[model samples]
Target: MNRDLLGRHRSVLPDWLALYYDEPLEITHGEGRYVWDSEGNRYLDFFGGILTTLTAHALPEVTKAVGEQAGRIVHSSTLYLNRPMVELAERIAQLSGIPDARVFFTTSGTEANDTALLLATTYRRSNTVLAMRNSYHGRSFSSVGITGNRGWSPTSLSPLQTLYVHGGVRSRGPYAQLGDAEFVAACVEDLEDLLGHTRPPAALIAEPVQGVGGFTSPPDGLYAAFREVLDAHGILWISDEVQTGWGRTGDHFWGWQAHGRNGPPDMLTFAKGIGNGMSVGGVVARAEIMNCLNANSLSTFGGTQITMAAGLANLTHLLEHDLQGNARRVGGMLIERLRSAAAQVPQVREVRGRGLMIGIELTEPGTDEADPRAVSAVLEAARDAGLLIGKGGGHNTSALRIAPPLSLTVAEAEEGAAILERALRSLP
Candidate 1:
């Protein structure tokens, strides 16, 4: 396909497509950190297509790798061993620091998560699964059941079947303030009491850092405490790094790494940036956990030929370009700038997150509705100023989720922040 900037043409969008919202822009092409439209206008992509385009669009090296692999072998079945598939799995193991960690690659994070659930249940012989409130695992039946967000309807969840724990409430935001110290400690104490009364959980899954819930990282020592509690109960601790892994978080290659002695989990799921822009995700299971692996038990096709090729290419790109290093630098800069901006503007309750995945939260000012107007004001204004962003949270409030490509330049970050600042000031 001769991919060029979108031609000047009006798209007759499908009427059958469900509308999540009334407005949807026609983005034409993307490269690096900017996207252009059919109208020949450019919008800086802070949203990075909800942070999926980690290496940017139409990246030459990644594309070339995909092309070459495609020409050679477009598909493969699990009945055979594929070179790229093995290589990709090896790369994941090395990057993840989990020795003897067996991987079950899949087409998406949700699939990997589902696979993790299967592994957890089969291995432990438990029925009840535990997850955080306001946390998003995926939209699939099992994942949605495991997901804690109330936005999901009963059609997708069995609230009676799954147990939802609090990720901790935001007294003022930054969640950093509520970190595992007091609030989390309270949760731990309460949870111990709850577990004492309620049924035992099969697995306790968590987003190493909350992704769709506004980039909320856990407070200090929180993970360690949670780990201890889960360990004592023989519950599997699964870290959902679908959004925070592959070096998006500064310093540690994994979000859990930054939690001091909190250490790793029994199982870890990674997606998003791992395959660069390609769609691929996998579950990294520790050896003790993998002892329960049953081949006939899992899906037919995982770690397929095409996806493995893309994943390898992505790993190569991260290593060669040092995107993780850039993520740290840019993420730190973004946090500093946002902290300063939020302080100056009381409307911004808190600015929290690590690396490029940052969130600018807008409190209700006085109500629980969260004043989406404040968030919309900033986002809409940014859009008018030629910047693209995203909104997420159970309340659908005004949280500006700024997760650009890890390759995002400081200049781009500065421009985006300025645009946001201008937008917030214009808010009434």
Candidate 2:
């Protein structure tokens, strides 16, 4: 049955759309941190549908809200006044940390980022933009142009002239050998040098934690240092929080808070996890930047009633349950356990991340060369052991990504970690 479905999927779907495993498994249903396949095999879900399932699978609160909203009205477009949309916008505006903020909703992180780029370019009147190395923004044309990870970037043609910046990945690069302070200085110096040779850019967009870049991040103060330089040149800072927002980072509510000594960014794009698997994304910016354009703009399905309702319920549940606190407590234990497991495996290059978003980079034993084969082997082994995980990296997709739902229990973490340890050990 799964084979037939896979055949049909390949026949119709784009070839670029990839699937996991040597033989793909069909997921039938899920609840809490576990999912069942079509054959009724149960598996612990660690990737959380690429971290979109923010709270949990089949969360009662979100499902109830979605059903209630659907019963009333599914969508009326942005042409009409939507109370749920307005309420969600207001809540997000207050939480965005920007003064006099305004929100524009989109259907995905790609659209959110595309809107942000449009605003930055039009407001600054410059087409040139700065992006970080080893970063993955989105799949749209404009977003793709800014993405520095070669594995994800499909084309060179772009609407904006994007210049790649340094410092997103702390472990690998020209400045990798330097100390934290020195690395920041070097990256800053490189930025200043780049600015001198190129046209003035509209903004410097970055991910607080490079999600598709093996969950790598620079020193805590790197962005703060870069902010000083950008301010001098009137370059706006846009934080892409699609993967790291809503307290996924444990120490802070937003990932940008780690480098927010000066203040919040000029704009931020968010999606994934906000609606607990529903399609909801948006851009939040200060009044001046957000309202720069004189022309009107609206997303037909951006702030539809159903999605807004789901977002509201999910956000409320997250805050009320203090899931961020839960993530910190549970994620801390999970990472330590995984680290101990990885210590025995020489192919485990590095284990890093904060909160529920962790990455275990794999390389050839006693060498720096990336071992994607080992990653593939571990992935298959984990699946056979009744655990679902994800893989990503800048270098040939050689990192294991473990991001369970924020509401993960201590027992679930222990179970998943044990399965993962056995999978790693089983690797050849």
Candidate 3:
């Protein structure tokens, strides 16, 4: 059955849309942290459908809300006064930390980011945008234009004149040897130098933690340092929190909080996990930036009633249970366990990330060269051992990504770690 579906999928779907595994497994259903393949094989899902399932699989609150909302109404254009949309928007506005916040919903992170780009360019009145080196914003033409990772970017032409910046990864590049404070200073100097060379960029867009860039992050307060520079130049700061938002990072509800000394970002884009598998994405900004568009705009299915219902329920459950705290506790144990396990493995170059968004970077034994083959082997072995994970990085896709649902338990974390440990050990 899985083979038949694979054949059908390949026949119809774009070849560029990648699927995991040597033999891709079709997940039929899920419960809590586990999912069953079409053939009845169960695996502990650590990646959580690219970290979309926030709280749990088949969460009762989200399920009930989705069902109830669908039974009443599902499709309503943004023109109407949708109660669920209004409620979710109010909650996000309060949580966003932006003064006089306004929210606009979209169907995916790509659309949300595109909306943000529109707002920033219009408000700042500049097409030049600064993006972090080895960063990925999204896949659409507009979002892809600012993406700095060559592995994910397919085109050179763009509507926006994008300038790539440094300091996304703290442990690599020329500043790797510097102390944290020195590193931040160096990146700020680099930004200042770049600003001197180019037309004033409309905004500097960055991921608080570069998701597709192997879960890499600069030292704390690095963005705050950059924010000071951008503030002086009147450039917007757009934080792409699609993967790092909603307490997934453990220590903060929003990833931008790590750099909150300079205050919230001028614009923030979010998707994935908020709706817990439902298509709900949006951008939040201060009224000045958000209301910059003079032309009217509307999203056909942006804040449709059903997705908002799911978002409201999921957000409520996440906050009520304090899943951020759960992510911290369980993810802390998991990363420590993985780190201890990787310490003995020469191919493991680094273990990094906060909360449940951990990454294990693989390198050739005793060399700096990325070992994507070893990562592939480990992924296959882990799947054979009844564990599911994800992979992403620059150039070679060398980092193993482990982002489980926030409701992960200690026992489950232990079990996943054991499987991953064995997979790493099985590497040849």
Candidate 4:
């Protein structure tokens, strides 16, 4: 527990392990936008545990719900319906805007993606699934299969590729902006070409905002184009809303809205804020599509009583307090502030994305820094200066994904952006 305590010893974790330890500022506890280390050193949680702790860590209402539920029932088999699970399902269905939807709950985004894969496979009995290049669905086998990124599926695991689409929510503006119309036309053309060349795909999956792909938000037209293509060829659009749901996108409660407004997807996947800070994820598909649905659960009651209690409390907090509105207010403030901040820093490449989900791309390959390294070095420096951030892009291309809680204040947003700006300027 005392790694650097008393200034006597460094941490003892093994170096050979595949551990991600970029944090120079260790974390022990968190509340709102702040975290404390074992030494009681405070750091701003701008990363929000990579945007999963939607309500922020250890919220009072969430704690009360869990504590009260623990005193009652922590878990119950999914075989018998639990009250908390039932309530949680109802809440998710109501919030998701999917009519007559059924919930297949899971513990993590990876598991939820796995469930989506199985359901898609079972429903269509087709061997094919499609996802966008540069997408990160999850780490499990099937999820990894649909994941267009090669890292998720190693060369050894490569079995004829699932077919990678060119433009994703995140694929645009790495160097140049892809017009919404061109991107849409390309998707239609690809689907038509793929359909003619091979069998029709059973399912097509995509993130509304590519979380790991650098907060990529596709232009408003991509969804409609996809829907047209899918409908023409009898494929389903499985919207991976894992990072863009639960009102994180500000303008809408879910990123699918940018698409759903045209028409709802055949299936929708969600995670992150679904349970606030607790672990909960789910899939909502057209009732008829899952009509042949059989419970294919790998999770221990992906719908557990304790998790449900936390989920309900968090959902209630979101609805009652209008966290989505807060996300819009604060997210816009952060975007505007970062725009100004980046203007003063030459290393900043671009600022893009919507609502609470945003990103700032830096000069790739560390052109500004004196010592050459991934431009993500700015992230490490920011963390040391007491602000948490996450970096992404397949080739270590420079970009930081910022999906803070809807509860983040404008003051906190400014402070966090200031930290990021200073870190970028201090490059070298």
What are the per-residue Cα lDDT tens digits for candidate 2 across 382-409? 9998999999999888799999999999
**Alpha-carbon RMSD of each model:** 4.0, 0.8, 0.7, 3.4
Q: TM-score of each candidate?
A: 0.89, 0.99, 0.99, 0.90
Instruction: Report clashes for each candidate as comma-separated counts.
Output: 0, 0, 0, 1
Candidate 4, 162: how far from true, in Å?
1.1
Sort the predicted structures by TM-score, highest score first.
3, 2, 4, 1
In terms of lDDT, model 1 sits at: 0.75
TM-score winner between candidates 2 and 4: 2
Alpha carbon deviation, residue 339, candidate 2 (Å)? 0.7
| Residue-by-residue lDDT tens digits, candidate 3, 246-319 | 99999898989999898999999999999999999999999988888999889999999999999999999999
Q: Write one digit per residue (lDDT tens) for candidate 4, span 1-428.
A: 35454233244554432323343444678888788877787778877877888877788889999999999988777877688888888777776677788887888888887777777777877768778877888877777777765544553253223877756743443322546676667666866787788787778888988888777666776777778877887888888888888888899887888876557787889887867767888888777765666765345768889988998888888888999999988998899888888787766767887888888877643353222243557767776787777777543444677878779988888889889888877865
Estimate the lDDT of model 3.
0.94
Question: What would the per-residue lDDT of candidate 1 be over residues 292-346, giving only the tens digit for each residue?
Answer: 8666653455776777877787778877988889998988987898787667666
CA shift of 303, model 2, Å:
0.7
Kindly provide the TM-score of model 1 when superposed on the true structure, using C-alpha atoms: 0.89
Clashing pairs in 4: 170-216
> Model 3, residue 111: what's the lDDT?
94
- lDDT of each structure? 0.75, 0.94, 0.94, 0.75
What ranking of all candidate models by lDDT puts the best one first?
A: 3, 2, 4, 1
Worst-scoring 10-residue span by lDDT in model 1: 1-10
